[model samples]
Target: MLISMKNRLIATLAILAVLGLATGLIFPGKHAKAETGKAVSPGSRMEAPAKLEDTAGLTAFVDGMMEEYMNRLQIPGAVISVVKDSRIILAKGYGSSNLEQALPVDPATSMFRIASTTKLFTWTAVMQLVEQGRIDLDTDINTYLKSVKIPATYPEPVTMRHLMTHTAGFEEGGVGYQITTDPAELPGSISETLNKHMLARIRPPGVMSSYSNYGATLAGMIVEDVSGIPYNDYIQKYIFDPLDMKYSTVVEPLPKSFIPYQVVGYNSETGSFIPGTPTFEGGFRPAGSATVSAVDMAHFMIAHLQNGKYGEQQLLKPATAERMHSTAFQFDKRLPGVALGFAEKRVNGVTLISHGGSDPMFNTEFYLAPAKQLGIFLSYNGGQGSEAASNLLQAFFNRYYPAPEVEQPEFAASAESVQKYAGSYQFTRHNSSDIDKFFNFFAQLNVSIAGNKLSLGSGSEQQLYREISPNLFQLEGGTDQIGFRTDESGKVTHMLLDMAPDMPLERTPLLDQSKFWLIVVGVLAVLFIAALLGPILFNRRFKAMTLAEKRAVRLSAGTAGWALLSFITLFMVVMSMDTMQKFTSISPLLSLSLGMPILLAGLTLALLVSTIQVWRNKYWTAIRRVHYTLVTLSAVVLMIFFYHWNLLGWQFG
Candidate 1:
């Protein structure tokens, strides 16, 4: 009648877990207060944790890691420095600034594309000006930049804090300055640009953290107007010169200031290294495009380490420096939290403040360990800066705080609950594999009750499904109600899923799993039909042409048309979600359902190319051979990718 000690403990644990689950449902938004470095505020003195552990070893690890990553990331070079206690514990450069000529990178002097790291500098300058009683953090920035105006979406005025923390409601529209896009299309001058784009609110100021390149650029505009100097000139006079950072420059400011060791920035698409574009031509674009060397980066970190002072000159109050490091983006707790222009994460009670930068040809990251007086600056030519930075950080974490292994608990699924999950689900596909990527992509469906919990199905992913009533079960892993609807007699029918709480299959299912390939084949047929029709409609002389000549005409017309369509197809695919990023990323289904037209377009062209060359080519053997060969190759490549992507399936399709 009595339970054993071990069983009692297990039962107690299970009961506690049930109690916890019930409590969680009742009090949903209760998260314990976060731990920061023990009440770190402005004016409160910090007891520095200066326990040094193999500073040189840490340097070698970071440098070696950066150099290795640079080789793969197509980055020209990177400079890294980690300092503690106002001392340079580690500073070095990896890879030549100019990879082609093999010019050496100097840790102390060689320059790099600092990217968004310049925000810290701009913020420092703003804070310095504030301490001197010129600008106010919470005041309307329009007071200084007379030309710039925030859209009157809000009942009251927008403040400088909006621009600083990216709560300014400035829709990015797209990447700040795309390589393919013209700079003319960018926010002309900082003021005009802000006036043109700054809306009152995507969410209320300080309500949600949406990143804004416009906001930071506006700050630069304010710095220029408030200081009565250009943004570049102001930073040079206040931030750079004071810190004695000679190598730091924004955009093309140092166009003529050449260092033989410098590497040109690259265009990501062309895969060829292009020279760096100036971040700001005029007005104020401050969020990105600051070039500096590792040595200069070290100096900047040292200034932060010294609580906003460089050598004898106290640039900002210690309070402001602390403010800059604190959390800035607090919109949704579930999403990654951010600090002003920086990302914040709490690991085992210690808060980590970090930011990553990616330009066309460069990438960079600067991590601050304020308590240890330690900071790491990882800069690279390509986008591998995040990789190197994350790797080094993870390695350090592994070394200092090795996680202890605990026993894995067994999880048993309810068979009756899982039984209801046995039917097919149909929805439009999404562009992103991630649930929220690009908003509503395509419709997705899952049938669970299989032995394996997860598998890579077709071109995308498969989720674990549990049965609820043989045709209705809650999606166990996510926050959605997905059911396999049934016919009157309880027979399985199509799937019904709510991608969004209120979306009505916002993405309607165009291709069921069984018929998706047929649909693709139909697309190819469309191309063929269109190709045939074009010639019949346009080329009057085709009727008079000889058999061989007629064949050549048909192949040529189809090939040319399809080839152009293929190009357009590729372009549209990028715009869908695969490439042309949904800047707002509001709905994932946009690309999945909407992209059907583009996909159908591509398939139609492909079919035209295929059908015309194989069967319709009018016996011009030579033209037919070449045309058919290219068509076959294109089809093979397209199908291979499609099949790989799960868009085309063998057994399932």
Candidate 2:
């Protein structure tokens, strides 16, 4: 059967994910344990550690994994450390300090961009306030929040707890030029940011889970409003100082003292370092914009591992830690049980708490299994860090906790409720470039327990997962509840999904991206015909008119043609890099859509230069030679550019 474009994208992603995690699914020779005395290279199979009970092998495993994963991901550098059994086991670095210089990575003192992981810290501070009775979780946030006003979602005010779990229902804004040119605007106080980004809600607070940076910023706003301290300052005084995380800071402009080992963020296309991703100096630090090494990150993770207590110091009550791990909003129990700021996943039935972080071009993930005394902190500068971490997680479970065999379920029970949601799927972020550093390429499970699957890119879609059996699943949320409609003869046809009162989804592009592009083109066509072509087609006379009529017609025709060509050129240049570089094949005098038009202009200039020589009459021969040379250079440059860029995937048409 022929597959659609959307279906093809899903299949390709499944293959990519499986191919990427090759080692994880099929562990052949070695058991998943780390060996002591004989150090096994990270990323390769390891012999089970002789002293399985000893913490030493686990320590080596942690350090080795960090270095190994960084290289696999092309990360500029990483500072990863592991805290197990309430102690720092390994803190190390791999790859280059600066992507340009390709220097050795820093181990102990290097810094990095920790991105949204900063939210965990921000949540930590907010919870600290909660523990102290300075804030109430369920009360309306606007009561404490000042300096900026939030447009409440409903007549009933939403609570702080709602925003904490990303159920605040705030629609997201595009990043890019804003984050690049005016990162300072992001750092403004929380209330100020709330006022700045107060848009309409997507759903009632706590009804559905939708991730929002603006929500976290508001949490940061309340922390500042009620505590009477700046966001980062609060984190330092309460969390960082007490935890002895000396190297940790919400990096804004990055301190000069940190110049030594700090990794420079890279833009892969230009092969240039991206300086100034602007960590939180004063504002918006809550939603994640911070930097630290594995050592410091390990300390933070270990504290959580030990349940909000470090040594004898009780940073947070053990009960509160339990609450943090427990889902405040079970907005999703399918993909993973996401709580306030963390996620709960059962790897082979062993529950673990995990959170992922990403910045301009860096990623960090921490998974802690308090049940098994296991913790993993993975960091890399490039986006591939997540896949590396997943592989490491597989190795980790193999070493510490091998996949246990499950007794077969009864035949009746196995087949009784075999739901129709089954198939692999992935999620691609909307309205963004491939080079974006945001959490744009978020992993979404297409989950199916039986034979059914969810569609990708549908709006207001509720993505859910339900395990029917090990390695089998079903989608539970709105998007997962897909059915089908048929013709009078009862043939399988259009799909029925729970999108706004359980409506039928047409098999066609009810809201396909290309359809929108077509609408735009249709509008342009109409304007072109009515405003430009219509006049010519409806002209009164055919041939033989006054010179004034001829000139007027020519001027109008030229103006309209130029305008139409301009829009077409812009559209082509933006949509397909394939059309940009041009050769003589595209007509040397082709319009601006193909870059050869510039070369043709150069040829005209060269001819003009030669004609000036003829008029001067002194250096006619020399000028002729010079003109030919100029034209030749332009032609050569055009050809070279077209050839090189085309060879590198810039196709000319």
Candidate 3:
């Protein structure tokens, strides 16, 4: 939710800047190439449309669309590959790789970081062990670990199945400082990183899916332990070497041989492409941080679509590959289900077994239709590139396989029940026991009931979901569904959206989503400004202040002033850093920086007592006393908001 909110804020602020409204708003890997399956060489351009056949027409149409979108979005480069019937239908690159040199992208060799898509390879490695009868998907993961043990938080031990489906119940980890520019800063072993950065399991295994990077890395380590080889080398020998994916690798700090093919990612700021640091995910490499070319990725897609066969080599038995695509968990029986490491998404009635990978600058989307023998992969090099990738995929699917005509099911939900479901929901994939829990203040889902429609957020931006059945709603006029779970009392406790039933959002109580807190922030902002100009606005009145009244005024203004400054300082510092570097870089200044909030919280107590003394005095007017009292009350709520979110504490935990 914080990520989505940040992206929306970025778009909003960028648009507002065009209209000159910029002043306000707290907004906020290397790998080697494959030696086999060569199709097009580096610097090869797209072939001109030949006679406009269905394939040729598609090439022309998509090429025009990609070029237009890339220019409009300021993306540095893009690569798209399509495989159908064990053949590469299209593998083309657009735009420039080196913006400085004007080097056009090479569909055959230009490498882009395929973030979390690396999980697919890791999952494949685990399945390979399963085929050899060396690892059990349902067995306790701790049984396989020799280096570190997960804390026994639940009777139900986490299994490889749970880890693959992202239902191991681990909270989200590796925020702020996980990614770095220096390879020397990373841990020597994947196990060492996993042990040091292990996340707390907040729920029993197989109960909820929080999309954990830690769980994925743990699975990779299991492969290492079971195979008696390092994780990266294991992937190379088993998966990469078998598939002849010579240009792809799971290694980090990228091998020197593949360095020439690397495409630099651009950060979109100041309406220009600024070259950003090459991010190394330290210990979190298994979850993401793999680089591969479009043509090599196409070979991967072909193997998966061809029942685990690439030419003569069979990576897995047809049955095993099918098992990998089987539904492991579904949010609702009616919605798409998660298939092992792949997430299930439906587009135009076509089931797309897919996974997307994204880093600070690069984004990747890959989808395969097993039945259709169709696969498409896209990678973009720019900050907002994911947005374009989404648009391109939607347009491609809608143009190709249109949705079938299915009659809409009619049902009515009682207003009482709808009202029960209407409330703010806090995402379960959050830091529950750490200071990161403070992110909840901005990362909340607001559900509103409008007639029979359930709208998310408020006003014009709300996405209305129509009630299709009791506790089941479909995004209005769209196929995706949201399911609400209720207790025996019929009070909604959780909502499952899309395929991720394991990461259902829990309802937030009124206190947690208090509107009064927003009011306090607004009132405090006014008081902060007033304090700066109060004496000038009423100089005569200030001159007549009694010693006690003056002291009271000073205390009230001091607390309010301190709170505002601390907040501004934190926001500015955080917003300025690269998103990945924001959290971890604050360590050097944390102790001193955290003192301001602690002081403000302490001053909140003093300000409250002084407000009481002001009421007892007779020198001040009734209006003055009331104004000061409200300001003091606002300050009290401000401190509580900071304290409740664990912001007042200096510890990151």
Candidate 1, which segments miss by more than 4 Å at Cα? 1-53, 72-76, 174-188, 195-201, 258-261, 266-284, 332-336, 347-349, 400-653
Best by lDDT: 3
Assess candidate 3 and give its lDDT: 0.71
TM-score of each: 0.58, 0.63, 0.84
lDDT string, candidate 3, 1-653, tens digits: 12333245335223111111111111110000011111121211233312323787778867866876677667889999999899998889998777877888888899888877888899998998998999999999888998979888999999999998888898764444456677777545788887776788888988765676778889988998998998889888988888778789878888999988888888888888888777776666777768999998998898888888999989888888999988888767777767888877666577778877666678787888887788988888885565566556555654565455577788877666578778888666666655555544555667888886887655444557888888888766656578887889878888877633344678876656646467767777887768646766887887798878778877877777787887777545434544555433445454466677888878888987888788776548898788887877777777777777566765453
Query: For candidate 2, lDDT tens digit of each residue in 1-653?
Result: 33322233333333222111111111111222121111135534344423345667766876676566554445556555656677766666777767566676665566776666777888888888888899898998878877766676576676788777766755443221113324444445555545643545645776554456666778888888898988778888888888777777875656678667576665344543454343232345576667777777777777787888876667788877777777665422233445666655555456677666654456567677888666766666653555456556666665556545554332222332333333322221112211111111222333333323233433332233333443233344211223333467654333322211111123222222234434644554454444356347756552454554344334334333443454455345443321111100132223244444343334434444544444465332465335433433333333332332231121321
Q: Candidates 2 and 3: which is better by TM-score?
A: 3
TM-score for model 2? 0.63
Least well predicted 10-residue stretch by lDDT in candidate 3: 28-37
Which lDDT tens digits does candidate 1 get at residues 509-570?
Answer: 33334245445545654544454565578566567667766655555455545544543453
Give candidate 3's TM-score: 0.84
Model 2 regions more than 4 Å off: 1-72, 99-103, 176-178, 181-190, 269-282, 332-335, 407-509, 512-653
User: If candidate 3 were superposed on the true structure by all CA atoms, what would the RMSD be?
Assistant: 7.8
How does model 2 fare in lDDT?
0.51
